[model samples]
Target: MNRFALCYFLLCVSSAATAQDKEVQAIRTRYQETAKKVQLLEQDPQNAALYVHRISLNDKGTPWPAVGNYKKTIKFYFELGDEQVHTLVRIDITSESAAHQYATEYLFDAKGQLVFCYDRMPDGQSPENNIEVRYYFSGDKPIRRTEGKTISDKPSPEQQPQAKRLQSDAAELQSLFKAIDK
Candidate 1:
């Protein structure tokens, strides 16, 4: 009778532990799915940017006018996978006649701790300003950061002054990214 009781107790304990492990695994799987979304976004910023922007596009392929007092807009995109989280935010500046787009990206670990981040202001064909920033982290702590900017270059005095400062800034950012990649 004593031996049977001991075996039963151990079996109960093992079953409880297995249940707990399954629960933990489920939570981790959900978290990982969320993080992967960000990695997918980074792999295709332009398409992702376009996808977000299309939420407000018109038939003519141009952005529609602001509806009311709201002239600026913000959007958040998230992805999780492999115990990592990626987040992207886009800020839009809208006026009566023009609009601008800015965005930020972030990454987090399985424990919901930030692991990396990247901020970007895409330099589209437009002659305008641009900016990019990146941060790398380890175990909820940032270990490195890189920032870059592109100021359009003003056209020569003999010609019309184009959005030169923004162009210049974009070029600078490109070189900066290249350096860091190496």
Candidate 2:
């Protein structure tokens, strides 16, 4: 084929791929929104299980951290089984004072129940006062967090913090999917 003809063929292929990516992305966005909306309807108090949204909540909030630092973040992990329950939850402090201590992790259930978690201050000045967590067995189910019943043997209320930084640049991530669709 002539040089111009070969170039045209390649262009067509690229265009097709881009179109496909857009369609798939559209579906993914819809599904994500559906899940979040469903959770909101089911829970309603803004305290139920957390779900991921198509757009990053951080996007609308303050700018990400500076050089040599991970960006601020608020994260939620959904369950993997039948209805995909929410297992873990966390919120980052997002302030410079906290620095390395941006996220103080906390564990929770789909019903917004608290569980054992780990947290340490950035200055390392905290004593045994550091975040303490305990686990207890309550009848058939595990009661991780206790309000004031140590005899009941419930775990303390704390959670593990999530990674503050994005795995990759957002623009690049979007472009990658776009390329795939083509």
Candidate 3:
């Protein structure tokens, strides 16, 4: 390749990388802002328009007692407003036993899109060691994920399926909210 052509190609690639970096930064900023809003709402729950529902689940992820077992409990949090059923914002799932404890928090945007998920569970190597993972999404697409102190801008193969499941669970919970509102 000629020297001029090589230089032009490098410049183009550099510009593209810079633009992508800006986009990722924008996404991160937006996620942080939304997270702050969620925090404020949580702090003053009594003053916010909030709806909460709790359900018990067995080891198989089904409703408790149906399988004659009790495992975890999931709490759904919805922001009540004109949109009503379309305002699902957060979900907290917790499980505790003699052997281990696990918890996960799913956060959604105003449009009922899963935007962030925080999971805490035993690392499996030891009962005292727990791992925490934070997954961030732009709409239905995972953009960034973090495990403990390590962060990755690229989403992993499993994150896609996990994102879909979280979204599906949010939708199901929203449907339940709609039914209850009726």
Candidate 4:
């Protein structure tokens, strides 16, 4: 009777695990199906130029500490045989009080989709405070991962200032694209 009870317990445990696996697999399938329905965007040169123009304007409007306190550079790359353009922005800000460099790269697909982005910024006095994020997108949905750190819990709004800035930047970029599309 004891041996029979142990076997039954093992079987039940295995069955529960198998059921959970099936549920996870089902969810993954649904996610993939939804992602497939998200259409890839086409590349538009005129629109792309407009996007660059608008972002450049915003970057220019960033208040520097002084007239000679900052330097800004923008570079664009077009992929061969792919309808993709990549833009890299570098801003070096120096103040008598402090100095830091901020850089971000944006990748847009042929379909005017912002497919990937990497943003890097200085964290307080500690190099560890430096925040870097790389985001991958399928259409408008973002899959994001941060390098060099882990968080035990979800960050509160106050703890996510950089993310908020990036989100705002992405929104502006999207609006520029939409304006050109119209």
Report the lDDT tens digits of candidate 1 across residue range 49-104: 21222123232345555632223332334332345423222222222224345554
lDDT of 2 by residue, 60-125 (tens): 445455533334443334333465433323222232332344333333333433322333444456
Q: Compared with the true structure, what per-residue lDDT tens digits does model 4 show for residues 135-179? A: 544455443434557521233455456555655676575555445
- Kindly list the per-residue Cα lDDT of model 3 for residues 1-182, writing each as its tens digit: 69999999999989976765675576567556655655766688666556667777554644444333338887777666765544666778888654568888877667766777778889888868999987777666666778878877776686667657766766776677567647
Give the TM-scores of the predictions, in the order they appear. 0.31, 0.28, 0.65, 0.42
For each candidate, the alpha-carbon lDDT, in order, equals: 0.42, 0.38, 0.70, 0.47
Candidate 3 stretches with Cα past 4 Å from truth are 1-46, 57-70, 83-86, 158-182
On lDDT, the stronger of 2 and 3 is 3
The alpha-carbon RMSD values of the candidates against the true structure, listed in the order shown, are: 20.8, 21.2, 5.0, 10.8
Best by lDDT: 3
Once superposed on the true structure, which residue ranges of model 1 sit more than 4 Å away at CA?
1-98, 122-127, 149-182
Best by TM-score: 3
For candidate 4, the C-alpha RMSD (Å) to the true structure equals 10.8
